[model samples]
Target: MKKTVTALIGLSLLVSCGNKNQAPLFADVALADEKQTSDWLAYGRTHNERRYSPATDINTNNVADLKVDWFIELPNDVGLVSTPLVVNGVMYFTGTMNIIRAVDATNGSLIWEYDPKVVEEVKGKRKIGWAHSRGISFYEGRIFAATWDGRLIAIDAGTGAEIWSVRTYDMERSLYITGAPKAFKGKVLIGNGGTENGPTRGWVTAYEADTGEEAWKFYIVPGNPADGFENAAMEMAAETWTGDWWKHGGGGNAWHGFTYDAELDMLYIGTGNGSPWNQKIRSPGGGDNLFLSCIVALNPDTGEYVWHYQTTPGDTWDYTSNMDIILADLNIEGEERKAILHAPKNGFFYVIDRKTGKLISAEPYVETTWASHIDMKTGRPVEVEGSRYEDGPADITPSPWGAHNWQAMSYNPQTGLVYIPTHHLSTNFSDEGIDLENWQAREFTGGLGVRRKFSDKQPREYSASLQAWDPVKQEVAWYLPQETFWNAGTLTTAGNLVFQGRSDGKFLAYEASTGEILWEFDAGLGISAPPITYTINGRQYISLLVGFGGGFAGLGADAAELGWSYGIHSRRLISFSLEGSAEMAALPPPYFPEPLNDPNFTINDEMAARGAIVYTSCGVCHGSGLIAGGMAPDLRASALVLNKEAFSSIVRDGILAGRGMPGQPEITERELEDLRHYVRQRAMETSTSDRTGSTNNPRKEVESH
Candidate 1:
């Protein structure tokens, strides 16, 4: 139900190999040459997106002494996924809304801030896609970033000032930039989004490192079959899809984080789901959708598809293959070999041979009922009948929220364990292909589907979990479940300690081997960001962005139906070390007040204006017209306006009873009236009186009059 936008951002690094399909404009800078000592430069450490660090200074013995040094709260709810990059004694990281800040790593103090001017409308609008900057890439003292609105920017890392900027994609067409711009071999490799929103074509392009010029673009999904990039690959890929799928635009996008294996010189990219999501609309007969939902090995220089293994072929369940593929060499089948480890949204942990892209062994790390098992024979999934949405509501466990979402995972080579922050949730999806003739022009252009609750909703009932998976054993070695929905990512040290924070405002260090609680502290708000460990002035410091919101809870995507609380929100950055003293004592989580039911509420002008601003909170899922993924009711529709009281009740108490849509705290009647009036005005301005067309059509702008 969410529209796709290119959110690929990059981080600091240099490339060892070049892709063939890449254009000529991207740079080919060499990373790790001169400046390779003790710095956390890029996202996931290297371009391979393996969030693992090689430093062993703070080993398991001293890790228990970790304590809070200092922290600061940001003003936005966008998930703080940034990893701090420390060079010398200063720390460079991103604040909310592409806000880059430099802080003194010795003491959590602000050094400087870089604010890339984002469009005002894109900042405040409901559908403006949570204007966020994940993290930045550093090269030659310059920091590079892909903006929230589709621009590749370079700022002086030392001064936090802009050096150069370029609009990489057409923002007018809704192409947004959320990826951390990766610098490798003089070229900036980046992937685009919009396939989820129904765009027929999506690609990963590289820009010249020094010049920000378009270098190359490798289309993840071929263009329209008939008039698309008419080639053998396109024609072959077309066969994998069904229906008049050209109109739907095959939507396998590379929207999540990706990785690169310098040893192999192959760039690995994880693809997304088909555009309409309904298999019948894609390729009805069903074949391997080539690169869609697959990890494709591409020539970093040419942008050519080398080899791919589709995670979810004929993807009808929105099981995007957009997981971070960590590169590692492990002893598997009694042989130590190079392998790419993937824990995709499909609920499986896959360890594939890196050299050949062949599956070594796969295992289910969660409660999965989709595929019976990964056939060792063909390396394909033997999907169960109930897994596909061919029939009505298929009861798929680990609903596309996934056993693992975008939360980054850390691979500790020492433990040979992948530390993942994962969730267990499910959704019931009823696939209804877009009636192209009846589609509307508004932004909410995805198909219709309802999310349901998975039986194991218990984990989320109290908290999510941090799991340590042993790929060799294909089993969970240890897990520490939290009473929070989201968790900051894991950071492991030579000390045999793993560091992670809970959404309930607690940051703790656990024994990596035993999963035993070793140390803990409260960071004020939930920590949804990944933590980084770096030494400043010979002192090792640990940092994490402490924020509540973003992801399932903040967006309220399928929150209620999925039994997630809606609006327990805040954003901040917290850093720690052994030198600081632990101040606060451990306390029980606060008791949340029951949802209020204030039916007497009504709206006034001033309150309406303020309410309009608050609506940004709802915009992550719902578009500007209050028309989102249909997960949230469209206020402009007849169903909402015709029953204002019912709308108010639903807002206040929630309609999906099991889904945690509790009403807000007591708002004055005047505030309620203002909210009602503002929504009513918005509805009148964008209502569709006659339902004669499909909402997926991009041409029909909604006008109430």
Candidate 2:
């Protein structure tokens, strides 16, 4: 077996050496579809989005012998969540700031690098370039990256020279690319993120692979009817909308998780949540917004819509279908059905007939509070009223984190099961108008109100689980739950093993049939990317991107509730193989800046309550509760907060917006005074505790979720 693999690799290298252009590196979609183990060609390994590997060299029996082969440290502090692609012994993925890196798959050695140079203009207290790019794609002798700065760039695969580039979105708008770029047939496809932060609309565009020319673009939501419809689909979708949705940008961004079916010649796009999240605000008449929270099928030749199945019609909870989608042929009711499997944010696992857009089965995979079930006949969810926060505040389980996020799930053909990274967290939803001043307080969650101040009433501590699901039976085969939430995506191979990383800093593999953990490595940092297996010179290896920060960073207060240390010191690309020994560099401990002592301040409970509300927006940049989760400074220890006059100047006036502190236009003199009182009190308490060697506040300890 070793000799055969070596000879095949040698022959391929000789063929490549005969003619050394980018032609030898081209990844044909059809050829990649049948591939199981030799190489990882596409994002999902195969165009079907199975995320399954056929490598058996590192089986469950010998997986314990696997050691770190090599590691590459990334340069940016932003999270690294890209599922890397390897072809012909070459590895490629995107780091923070959408910087692309090409590495030798066998050893962790950098070959070439390309920085998108995402311009970072500070918007008040926030910098612009912190967003991430999930991964990149190889096609037509070129490498493609959908950058956070809203550009689709193609680079020479062999060399790191820029081939051609095109701006995909308006710089003025918040839309940027974070999902992996995909290439199929003769075109490359990319999507954007940012609808959650602004009145953004979502659209997916396809470009000519050879040239950076726009081939076709598909808008998720209908635009102004006056502008005329882009196609018949828009005309049909417009009828389901009742208000001036176009003004709100009617989101439905195909932000992440797209799959392609070569056999059906169909492109499956999972649309995102609505812009204003609250449907009543965006569309007062309350019609089922077409395309939003839906898995729509489109024709790859043209950007024409074929069929769609909406998961959450009138979506008000950010229940996006933008989670990963897997295609499989399952036997059900005595027949083999071609189906698309989806476990979206809505907390339901759906099996739809991919050809005609019919719902074969839709069942809740988690403890879903908003909907009881989906009616098979109508294919609509039986929503629980008040779940939309129509009458009052309603608590929804599985929160906006969904039962799952963009973390890629894997479907193993051998085990006939899918492994998913799932979370158990809930949020209290309220339908109330946020004060215009505080509108910016929360990252554009459609001006919706959510409170995670669990304080006694919130559910038990949030948790994460690796669930092995039986897709055909629509049931969970086994589950391994953890105390920590926000675990990484899964990768399953023919070796009866499943691999995933944890937010609490561990990379693990579990027995495929049972839930017993087979092996684990203390990564010492969070990972959001899925694991992938590939071979170079007859050696099968595993690799995944690691770093901890992304959407959850901007999710207000308790956003850090899920095990992130807030320390953003390291980003690494880790690879492992049987008995391979490589040492990873040590990680710096979490930042604990010294607190400024304030001997003159008095604690005021009322002032603290008022200040708490004011601090919500600040927590987006600084960690939760002014306790540094490692992104920014621990305000409780800042000298800026120690001085009352300086605090007032920076807080009340736009004095340091360029320095990333947007002044509070919503706070009056009295409110400013109250905020000063609160920060002073917290700072004093922290300083005293540090000096006296007392334990941290229980509330703050729990913030690490």
Candidate 3:
């Protein structure tokens, strides 16, 4: 086996040597193994998804000397949350609308830009997902990017020209791509997210790098049994589910958390939650629900499922395992084992055997009330009484926003610790008056069978933290509390430093071992993306995207309090180095939109009540109560909302589709009027005094069904 692997590697090198311009297949394998560290070649720096750099030029002692090396403003972009990849002196990243840009690594200068033209491609059919792509992928001299409209296109690494394009799914469905495409072994993999939008049976597809031809696809959840299974794995998964789950789509979308192990020759993907989130509606006779919220290992060459470890079995609280799957070697009980460290939404920090998919240890990284603990004997979480909200409404800790979301965490083998960007928010889960037996999924809107409410009265202790946890000991080594519940991801280095950005526009670095603050920089905008470090011309530089907007950023007032109002701050890609000196333009102070109201307009209660339901579709990007959380416009403060003709032009006629406000062409005339009434109602209710402390208030009484 060793000789065969060596011969294959040697042949690949010879082929690459024969053609100097062509990149060899699996050229990033060395970086994945930490043998190459000068460039960041993969989404998580390497295929291990560790997000740790071995470069030590910017160590703890010198990180304080770091200043602005170069910065570029993205004038026409929003939600800049992608990790910029640096390969061979060029930097590549995806911004709003899945627009790919290439720049010089030595100096931030545009080399080329490729716009997917997502708004034009979808033709105003998609209104929810537009500007929230996490990243793009690079492999074999080609850059792979998945568009918001479900098209995966491979571009030439040097010219930014489209090489080939393939549509991953039908456009009529509510599905969208927000996660980065994972490229490995000459194949690029992409997944879509829309668990609560409609009937979505989640799956991940792998395509050939050179061509857009489909290689293989592995469905995260099984389809209808009467239609027969795609393979033996889907048939085996069907037995763990009850009722006609296929009708509801049995969601297990692998939107994130994809890691490839070159040594073991395996692919690992973390599956998402159930379609409706309520087991009573999706799986009447409660079963484990097989693959939902699970980490499944597969044969990458064939997309064949090998083994899986379910994290939140029969997941009822939107506890998705689609967070981060980091592979590391740990010493456990005098034995070295290949382990997968996972801190999923359920609030448990898990260590599982990556090779065999066996549980090693599980502990809560935050306050978790849904499950008391994980039972090692059965490798399942021991649920608390009435925690499922079956008996009544249950207040649970670690809300659906998750203790940890898609924000990447970094695992440093040198420090033997995983630095996690964690939160402590909780939610009140209830199904109070819903007809569970007759429930049906809704299209392009939140169809969650359960209703979740956040309490403004909750203590501030339920905030966020940057925790340095020892994976081997299964305990926190050190932690630093954060002011806001949502922040960016972490990056660790062999220089004993950890870097992270905050929602308050501050990028900071801390001592990896003790969590001591080392350096800080004011980025001038909220950052929801991880930082990456790379070296060119023997000089090291750190780059981060400065803009915040994701699932949590759209969660009404809690996120609005940050004051990263839409169009108020500039989104930028900023880089820093020890020897650099560049002055950044001072940004305007944080501005909060004052709700505009008209004394002459009379309130229509009936229309407003109906509009609240239609607002769910808009709330995914705009805030829940018409508040703007830096992602989109706050309709309550917009003059356009008061004018019927102007509003119709922007919303119904797709006039502003080019600006990221996708027009809802399917909405009727009456529905549009109702929406206007609802926005006006919210504006009238929020006076000057109410705006001070109302951002964290509970959502309006209208259920998000």
Highest-scoring model, lDDT? 3
> Which of 1 and 2 is the better model by lDDT?
2
**What TM-score against the true fold does each predicted structure earn?**
0.77, 0.85, 0.95
RMSD of 2: 6.2
Off by over 4 Å in 2: 1-17, 21-23, 120-129, 432-446, 449-462, 553-569, 585-594, 598-618, 631-705
Model 2: per-residue Cα lDDT at residue 586: 66
**Winning candidate number (TM-score):** 3
Which candidate would rank higher by TM-score, 2 or 3? Answer: 3
lDDT of each: 0.61, 0.73, 0.84
For 434-531, candidate 1 gives per-residue lDDT tens digits of 35334422232443222333332332443257899999999999987654565667777666778887665678888778888888776655556778
Candidate 3 on 1-705: residue-level lDDT in tens? Answer: 001111121121111334543443445565475756678888898889899988899998888999988887777778888888887777888888888887777666666678888878866575557577888887887888988878999987766778999999988888888889999988998888989889789999999887889999999888999998999999999999999899999999988998998889899999999998999999999999979999999999999999999999999888999999998999999999999999999899999999999999999988888899999999988999999998898888778878899899999999999999987777788998899988989667648898877744443453788999988888999999887767899999999999999888899999999999999998877889999999888898999988887776676676677788888887888889898888888778888899887887787999999988778778867887777677888888898989999998888878877677777788899999998899989888874545432333323322455
- Please give the distance, in angstroms, between residue 185's alpha carbon in candidate 3 and its true position after superposition: 0.8
The alpha-carbon lDDT assigned to residue 485 of candidate 1 equals 60
**Candidate 3 root-mean-square deviation in Å:** 6.1
Q: How do all the candidates rank in terms of TM-score, highest first?
A: 3, 2, 1
lDDT of 1 at 120: 41
